[model samples]
Target: MMKYILGIAALLFFSCGNKEDILLPKADRTIVKEVMDLSPIYIFFRVNGKDTLAEVNRKNSISTTNWILNIDKRLPLRLVIPEVMKLQEKRRGDSAHKNEAAQNYYSYADSIGKNLAFIPFTNVHYKMVKPKAEVIVFFDKSNKIWVNGLMIKNDKFKNFINEFIDKKSENYQFCFSEDLSFGNYIQYEIYLQSLKINNGQEFIN
Candidate 1:
């Protein structure tokens, strides 16, 4: 699925859909892991509040070759020790002609895995997105994964509750408190003005 890139923001947003189209889909923990496994490594750059969500893989895509969205200070946050600089930096790794620095970052993130016990979950605040508040989400994979969600109280995450996860539909894992949103993991990519959030119930897409 290595596609070409040009315009920074290339996200495919969904909105103004039928009720059936807006149903919250559940992502099996295993499938969620697979989503990362199947795709190329993803990286994000945050400088001057501008974000560039890019993608790469062990195969074709690499470096800035596959930029998903060249966002200027949008989306959520990451727990990088040092803040991401605005200007793009070319480390020695970039000299490999394959963006080795990014590859290394992917390797490190992959090594950590999503298992909190093996590696603590790192989160970034979704401050720039809708609802205004800094929405924090768990991102522990080599590639950054995003999902549109329905806001619900009680921290309810998955629409379809699993055995290990909390059974309550209202209580999700991503929610900091009762203010949880159901991410349409099986849905589409996040795009500015590309989608709609409906009272945390069902979004346009």
Candidate 2:
């Protein structure tokens, strides 16, 4: 499903194919505005410990039935993006592709195009480096907030969600859904309440 598009990418790096039968909105849409208000509602959560960006992605995939929080699409360069970007930036100094840095750089660039499918669509996922359990805060590189793929940063809302989870159910899981009736939509949040998660847990209908 399109909703899990970001989550799956976050979980693991699976290379399928460059060519797809994705039914992109066929409007002479020369320019699709990166409308902040029009962005998808990203759901992000924090468990107990500190983890790398790669680990966080895995958690997101595991908690497919959990709830979420939204953040702007624009991510901070100081975060994971910088490391990935640096991989490429350092390689530019190489006069030729004979250096290890250059090879790694080019490999990273190719991997991005193959892996970060949602980033291009403006869905930037975010995770806290050192998480504070009580303090549920969102991260942003700049003031410009858009709904990319990051989690929420509001204290009040974050607390509210945590409290809601405590009282409602133990599984603080959820996933996004779209209104296909219009062939497009404002995303809908689906919480996996009773459905048991298994090897095919994600196959829930």
Candidate 3:
């Protein structure tokens, strides 16, 4: 009887230990936890597969059109684009049933991509650092860039920006025109990210 009790106690201890292992925090848990805690509706992407947008829709818990799509860095662009397009398609379809003003807004947002339509409730994923000396970077619809209210040619951006960095500019803010394409906006964002800024910080407005 004594041996049997000891065996049972050991099994229970191991079982609890296994459960604790599963609850341990991971490196990427910060963003995941933040999104889960703040977002009313969110879809998580995984290596093997992902949670379907259809599944989320079917649940009827999503009251808003916006949903957080949490994707892994390793996920292929080909796999992700189709899903994103589906969301865009749904947004377009939703606009059809709305009033004329709402429809127009949707069209406008699609044309330039809405920058402020939705925002993260928490700043856990990224930091918002105030710049010491604000240097404004504006992008027009024609892919033209303006630095500190001065127009600079597309090819001359590197040279123009280097001057600012040389001046020890610590703060950078990016602004987009209403008619700018989403692709152009993303391209510039990538380009700016590769630059060696003093504080390595930029904000979109």
Q: Which structure among the candidates has the greatest TM-score? A: 3
> Which scores greater on TM-score, model 2 or model 3?
3
Score each candidate by Cα lDDT.
0.24, 0.24, 0.36
- Model 1 weakest lDDT span, ten residues long: 115-124
**TM per model?**
0.19, 0.21, 0.34
Q: Model 3 scores what on Cα lDDT?
A: 0.36
Q: Could you tally the backbone clashes for each prediction? A: 19, 12, 0
Model 3 residue pairs with clashes: none
The regions of model 2 sitting more than 4 angstroms off are 1-48, 51-77, 98-205
What alpha-carbon RMSD in Å does predicted model 3 have with respect to the real structure?
Answer: 17.1
Report the number of the highest-lDDT candidate.
3
Predicted candidate 1, C-alpha RMSD:
18.2
Per-residue alpha-carbon lDDT of candidate 3 for residues 1-205, written as tens digits (9 for 90 to 100): 0010111101111222331110111121121122221112222233335432221221322323334433322223334334445554554556445322221101001113211122221111112232234677777667778877799888888887787655354466555554443334444544554564424333333
**lDDT (C-alpha) at residue 15 in model 1:** 22
Ranking by TM-score: 3, 2, 1
In terms of TM-score, how similar is model 2 to the real structure?
0.21
| Candidate 3 runs further than 4 Å off | 1-134, 166-169, 198-205
